[model samples]
Structure formats: structure tokens, C-alpha cells
Target chain A: MTPFDFFILSGLLFAVGLFGVIVRRNVISLFFSLELLLNSANVLLVAFSRLHGNLFGEVFVFFVLAVAAAEAAVGLAIVVALYRYRKSVNTEDFSTLRW
Target chain B: MREVFFYLFAFLSVVFAVVSVTHRNVIKGGLSLLASFVALGAVYFTAGAEFIGIVQVIVYGGAIVVLYLFTLMTMDLKNFGKEPLRTISLAAGGAISLFLLFSILYAGYRFYGGSIPATVSGAKELALPLFYRFLLPFEVVSVLLLVATVGAVAVGRREE
Candidate 1:
């Protein structure tokens, strides 16, 4: 398949992930959407690495994966902390700073 | 053929992602996300990124989803009340994403993704650049992971 195919896949996935982030109320779901966004970017990166006849893009993906894992770990910790404070995971409830 | 597998997994990835996002049950959503990741891994395989495909399945489908499920276990699920949908926000979100999708497609309409690879990339091929050329970034990422681990523990620990 062409690299265009990969880009189209990435774009659609990214759009869907962005929509989920905007509309979802749960913190966990927001994280899921975030993962989707990362995955979309990964797809495009790998395709392009192949496109240019280099492994650099693929190598970068390892960094992206590490970053994503770290983000998920820290983000989930924040969610748990927020949940302990508010007793709910809904974004509507965690608005103590919404002045 | 590679094209067939690529298209198939690509479609599956998109479908599963939507299902994961829209499902009311968080557990179901998480599982669907797992499916989507596996499909994406398959896409990488078909695209000739063999090592990336395997790593995607192991790290994303195995590690990350399990992390989510573990965090979910700590919270009581029954108490998560129904979130009422507002028509205005729904319309706005849909409109905005649709616009983005259209714009992205238009910008890349004439552009092709790139030519297909002559050789499939395996770990041996990938390891060369990762260890040599990107050694500094690799070390930095390791440090980032370590920091994130410590930070997560610090944030999540109960205060005495």
C-alpha cells in the first residue's frame, strides 16, 4: 500500500480520538482517546520511515512508545488522585479550579 | 497480499477505536481499545515494520491496557453515574472533527503516503539506528520513564 493510505488512516484515527477527548466525561476515557492519538501518529511515522528508506522514523517510534507509557502512568496516577479527592471520575466534578 | 491485510487491519483499527470511545461500559471500552491496538500492530506488520508491529502488540495491547484495567479496579465502577449528552456539544464536537478530517484529506489529497518498502524491517535492521544514531534520545527516554514511574508513585501515595 501507499504511504497516503497510512496518512489517511492516521488522520481518521486522530480525528476520532480528538472527538472523544472533547466529548468524553470520564478521565479514563479521555486517557483512552489520548492513546488513540498517539497510535495514529505512530502509524504515520512508521509508514514514512519506510517511505524515505531509513529506520530513523521507526527508531523514533520507540521514543514515542516510552513517552506514551510514561504519560499513561503519570496520567492514571493523577486520575486516581483526583478520584480520591472527588470520589468520582467525571470531569464535571473535578472543577475545583473552575473560577 | 499485503494490501489486503493492510486494508483489513486498518479498517478494524478504526472501527475498534470508535467502539472503544463510544461504549458506555469502561471495561468494554478498554477491551475494544485493546482490539484496536492489535489491529494497528497488524497494520504495521503488513506495512513491513515487523519489529514495530510486535512491539506495538506487546507494549500497547499487553502493557498499557492492563495498566488501565488495574487502575479501573481501584475505583468503584457502579458509582460512575450517567453523563447526560448535550446536543450543542455533540453538534460542536462532530462538526469540528468533521472539519478537521476534511481539511486533512484536502491538504494531502494529491500527496501519496510514499512508495512501498523494498525490504521488511526487522529488529536487526531497527537496532542499528536505535542504538547508534539515536543513542542520546534513547537514554533520555529511559530517564523520562524512570521519572514518570517515581512521579506516579509519589502522586498516588496516600498522605500520612
Candidate 2:
């Protein structure tokens, strides 16, 4: 009901997503975590938009949603292509790009 | 009643997200994530962002997660191999995220007792700002989607 409750929700989701991002080895799970991160931000945005009594933040959420979709498309394409080449989705296997 | 539903859905979403993150089966994890998103849409609805709630269900629950699941279908899941948990990394990730969570809560402490105004943001109300004020960004997002589509196709295409 309060903005603080929303802050708690967003923060917990963000924390969970960050942990997944750091600990997960699979590209697919990483993407899931990334999406969660984006969603957490969206939650806060919607909350703040309600707080300010304006639609600007809601409008911005639309852009974020669009960008998230594009990111998912491009990132998944790269992961799938990489899987074709290497036959593995593990992060350790894709370290050829690492210095 | 609204606040009750809001908290219920919010709690459910967070629980589902944790399950999604920690689940061993990727398909099951994706399903859990879908449930989480749907629950979040309910949260949005309770908060009075009706259009956003619907769009969240459609775009996130319907489109994005399904795209992930479809991409998953093309791969052999049996060969995913188990990830060995490293204690050091586990501790690090846990510590860092916990720190972040505390800091975020601290930052928002002043807003703890404050309630947001009751405002219903249906599509009709949302359109005025989106189509009028943010028209340029709207068009740019369209172009961005187009570019992403092209780039994905080019990258995923196999050489003859």
C-alpha cells in the first residue's frame, strides 16, 4: 500500500536477480535473471509514477519494455549461435573472448 | 482488499522468482518465471496501473518467456551438465546482494510511511502522454525493434 512496501519488493527482486547473475553458469538462466532485474526496475517505476500522480514514468516503462524485448532477441540469438558452434551453453566454455 | 491482493501477489512473485533462479530444470525454471510475471501483473493491477498490468501479462508472460521456452526447445536439455557450486562465489554473490538490499531499504526509509495517491492509469489515460509527448521515443523504439530483428536474423542464420 505504501511506497516503502514497493521499495522492499523491488529491492528483494533485484537482490535475487543479482545473485543469479553472479552465480549462474548457463546463458539461459543468466537471461532469466536479467529479465528479473528489468522487471524489478519496472516495479519501482510504476510505483513512483503512482507516487507522483503522472503518466511519464508509465510511458518510460513502455520504452524499457521495448528495449528489454530487443535485448532478449539479440542476446538469445547470440547464445543460440554460440551453442551451435560450441555445443554448450556454459559460461566457462565461451571464454575464448576473454583476455 | 486491494492492499491484501497486492501483498499476496507481490509475495508470490518473489517466491516464484527465487524458485526460478535456483531450480535445476531450466524448463521448470522458465515456467516458474512465467508464474512470477503473471503474479507481478496482478501486483500492477492492484496498484491501479491497469494497462501496464495487462501489457505485462501479454508482453512478458506471453511473448518474452515463450520466446525463451521456444529457443530452449531447439537445444538438447539432457546435456546441460550440472553446475558445481563454488563456495567462494556463492558467499560473494550472497554478501554483495544482501548489502545492496540493505542499502536500498535504507535509502527508502523516509518513504516508509508515505502512501502513493490513488490513480488509475488505463490505456486511454496512458495514450495522451505516450502518443503526444513521447511520440519521438515511440518511433525510435519501433526502429530499435526493427534493428534488433534484423540483427538477430543475421546472427542466427547459418552460412551456406
Candidate 3:
């Protein structure tokens, strides 16, 4: 496959993920969108790695994956705590920290 | 053959991603997100990053999506209710995403000019750099995972 094709696809995925993050109100859905965003970056990184004939980009993808996993773990825990406190996952209900 | 798979998976991923975002049911959205991730893994494989593709399937498809699903199981899905479907926010998001997509495509058109290099032996060749030159970062990622595990437990624990 062409690197350009990969990049274009990755860009579309990233854009869709971004739109989800912005428009979604449910916390769980937001998290899923975040994962899509991260995976899109992974796609680009691997494509670039192949394009440049270098392994650095792929190595970076590994690190990004690790960080994403950690972020998910922590983020879910926070969501659980929020659920317990407010009993809702809607972003609009998460106004306690706003003021 | 390769281009066909690429287009197929790319279409699958983008379509699923949009559905995942727009769907009101969180569990279904999460599942669709998983499908997108799997399609993305296939894209990586088609691009010749075999090891990364496998890892993508295992880690993202297997572990990460499972984590989200488990978290979803703990929540009351019935309480999700109807979303507001804000026109302004949707318009804003759509506009920004469209702008980004076009800009990226324009840049690619200008730079690549429809000529993309062929894929090399990424999986096999990545080994040396990963184990030798990038050994430190590799080990560091393990350490990071360990710390994340500990931190996640600490943060989630209920102290009475």
C-alpha cells in the first residue's frame, strides 16, 4: 500500500475521533473516541517508519501504546469514581469541578 | 490485492469510528471502536508492519477494548438517556475535521505526488533497532507499564 494512502486514512480516522471527542457527552463514549485517536496516530507512525526505512517511528508507536494503556486505566478509574459521586456519566453533570 | 484490502479496512475503520462516536449506546459504540481498531491493525499488516499489526490486535483489540467494555459493564447503560445533539457543537466539530482532512490531503498531494515508496521488511528489520539501539526505551516502557498498574490501583482503591 502507498504511504500517502495510509496517511490519508489515518488522517480521516484521527479527524473522526476528534469529532467524537468533541461532540459526545457520555464519558465512556469519549474514552472510546480517545482510543481511536491514539490508534490513528499509531497508524501514521508505522507508515512513516516504513516510509523512511527507519524503526524509530515504530518504536515510538510502542511507547504511545503503553502510555495509552496507562491513560485508559487511570481514566476508567476516574470515571468510576465520578460515577459513584454523581451517578451520571454525562459531561454536563460533571460541573462540580467547573466552578 | 494489497490496495484493495487497504481501502476495505480503511473504509471499515472510518465508518465504524463515525458510528462509534455518534451512537448513543456506549457499549455499542465501544464495540464499534474495537472493530475500527481491528481494521486499523489489518491496515498496518497490509502496510508490512507485521509485528506491530499483531500487537495492535492483541493489545488494542484484546486488552484495551476489553478494559473499556468492563468499565461499561459497571455503569448503568439504561441511564445514558438521549443525547442533546447540539447543532453548534456538531457543526464546529464537522467543520474542524473537514478542514483537517482537506489540509492533510492537500499536503500529501503536494509532497508525495502520488508516488509512495514500497514497503520494506519492517517487522524483521525493526528487531535490531528495537533490541539494540532502542533497548533503553523498550525497557523504560515496561517500567512505565508497571508504574501505571500501581498508580491505577492506588487511584481506584477505596480507603475507609
- Give a tens-digit lDDT track for model 1, residues A1-99: 877788789989988898898889988999999999999889888987888889999998888999999999999999999889889999999887899
Which is the better candidate, 1 or 2, if ranked by TM-score?
Answer: 2
Q: What would the TM-score be for candidate 2 when compared with the true structure?
A: 0.99
Kindly report the fnat of each predicted structure, to 2 decimals.
0.78, 0.78, 0.64
lDDT of 2 by residue, B9-98 (tens): 999999999999989899999999999999999999999999999999999999999999999999999889999899988999999999
List runs of model 3 lying over 4 Å from the truth: B114-124
lDDT of each: 0.91, 0.95, 0.83
Best by TM-score: 2
Clashing pairs in 2: none
DockQ of each: 0.78, 0.88, 0.69
Candidate 2: tens digits of C-alpha lDDT, residues A4-64: 9999999999999999999999899999999999999999999999999888999988899
Query: What class would a CAPRI assessor give candidate 2's docking?
Result: high
- My TM-score estimates for the predictions, one after another, are 0.97, 0.99, 0.94
B136 in model 1: Cα distance from truth in Å? Answer: 0.6
Q: What are the per-residue Cα lDDT tens digits for candidate 1 across B1-160?
A: 8899999999999999999998899999999999999999999999899999999999999999999999999999999999778888788878888888887778666656356776799999999999999899999999999999999999999988
By lDDT, who's the top model here?
2
